[model samples]
Target: MIKHNIGLTSAEIGGLWEAFFQETMSVCLLKYFLHHIKDEEIKIVLTKALDFSHLNIKKIKEIYSKENIPLPDGFSEKDIDLSAPPLFNEPFALSYVYIMSRMGMINYAFITANIARSDILSFFTNALAQVTELYTDATTMMLSKGIYDRPPKISYPKKIEYIQKKSYISGFIGQKRTLNAVELTEIFFNIERNYFSILFCLGLIQVVKDKEIKNFIKDGKRISEKQINFFNEILQKEDFLGIISVSMEVTDSTISPFSDKLVMSLFHFLNSIDITLIGHALSMSMRADLSTFYSKVIGEILLYAESGFSIMVNRGWLEKPPQATNRKNLESR
Candidate 1:
């Protein structure tokens, strides 16, 4: 979705808004996806939706450039607070997707209005229409799956006050809690499960294509194995399940709608995602259990993240963020 807030020019705020939305929404999208989706075909469709949103991040920047707007570095992927529990559970995932789709529509409509002179606006408008359809389909799918959760309605007049007071606590404090060994096991497997599920779907990203996704998945699958192994060791004697049996089970359809350059960019993005996943897993593991098991797991994931970082650099996809002030000097070499 696009933004229409009357604060700044497309150049000044476009990248920031895009980054802000994509970075935050992407994590939530991934979480709800892991909870609700099981079919490979369905996962593919969702992955395509994710690709659209991700690519729009770039398009927003390009649109800003076209409008002579100076895009601000508003935030990074870290801006999103995914550790907070989702607003709803699995039953609400589809509705959440729908809500996000509507948000995308609003965003794109605003972009179209602001940049009526740009060709990309036309493309975004087309995208907005399709996203509406995707939301419709996703909602229907959720209904068919018997898992659609709608926004809550007011049941009591005092509920507003209750929310005003407690929403802060619940949003910040109540959402995330340390899981027991059993809960911890579920959490790790759940992330692993979604990892492949999204990869299977990303095979359809029009810009990035399947081979890039497959290669990145190849690297990711091994890291996930390592992370699970580390966790299983942590859960020793607890009869906790780690990376037991899993499968991608993707269909044979292989066609890409994106350019190769974009595909490479996305693969790089996935690599960053892999490294971050390990960091989060390790961080949570440490917080939940200060035992040797957790420490060892962190060490293992640290190595894995470093390895992915090496690969990311080797692929020439290491995006020098703002902190890398000396990169210009290094690049000149």
Candidate 2:
């Protein structure tokens, strides 16, 4: 390990703190999956995933100890029940790991870019590399199994042509142009993500015991289904079929494998990711209709996320992050 005399900056602290919680939550979920997974190949992959989460937690704890920062009380064994019946089938477990690894890569890259300290930077850089390898492994396994949902293919243009008319960007008015490659790619990716979100919500909804929490998850499922239909309709209008994974399956198990706190926290984490992706899609989209749709759904998602936050706060489950000192109160004293 590289030794650094310099203390961590706010960005480094924030990133590490958030990562601690994320990895701990992942450890709980991955352990449950490992207990139920039967496929030897997938079992190996999940074991690797569990090991990575444990390693991350260990490193973060060391850093916190060196800095004299109290460790966050992240998810623990109490939050998960290993003996509960399997909530998802084998294929869905593999797919979940694949998608989560992709998300992890994005998150690690962002954190790595923001940190200046050499030690913290090295940690995130190594994390990015590990998650990238995991992503590749999952993807290769999916492809070999013929379960990968490939994006739609477009014919190669014979000649390079620039947009000569303003109508090329317009979609709500007369003579709307067919979806461009970039636009189609965003739509397809969003649809793919929502499909997974629907499955996740479906599995959780069946086992969640709290009435309010169950209703919240049910609302999330409905939103995902609506968004999928919206994106699919856009593709259908252009004579392109939407991509859906046939391997995604949720079991009929009603046994709760996770605490209500963990479930709510997971939903909040995923909602933040969904909002970020939709904002990126909005930036890439040029058509009025697509842009309008993204903007509207962002508001809807934000509202749902806020409701979840309120629920967590009311139940005293939301952990507050470190904040600046209250100078005003000190001055008054």
lDDT digits (tens) for residues 76-132 of candidate 1: 434233343322234334444554565455555655566543354565576678678
| lDDT, each prediction | 0.48, 0.89
TM-score of each: 0.39, 0.96
lDDT string for model 2 (1-333, tens) is: 996589988899999988998999999999988999899999988999899989989999999999999999989999999989999989887887898898888888888999999889989998898899889989999988887887889998899899887776774456678888898888888888888888899899889888999999999998998889898887887888766657667889999999999999999988988898899999998888889999999999999999999999999999998787899999999
Q: Give the distance in Å from residue 261's predicted Cα in candidate 2 to where it truly belongs.
A: 0.9
Candidate 1: which stretches are off by over 4 Å? 1-217, 229-248, 253-264, 271-333
For model 2, name the residue pairs that clash. Answer: none
Which stretches of model 2 miss by more than 4 angstroms? 1-4
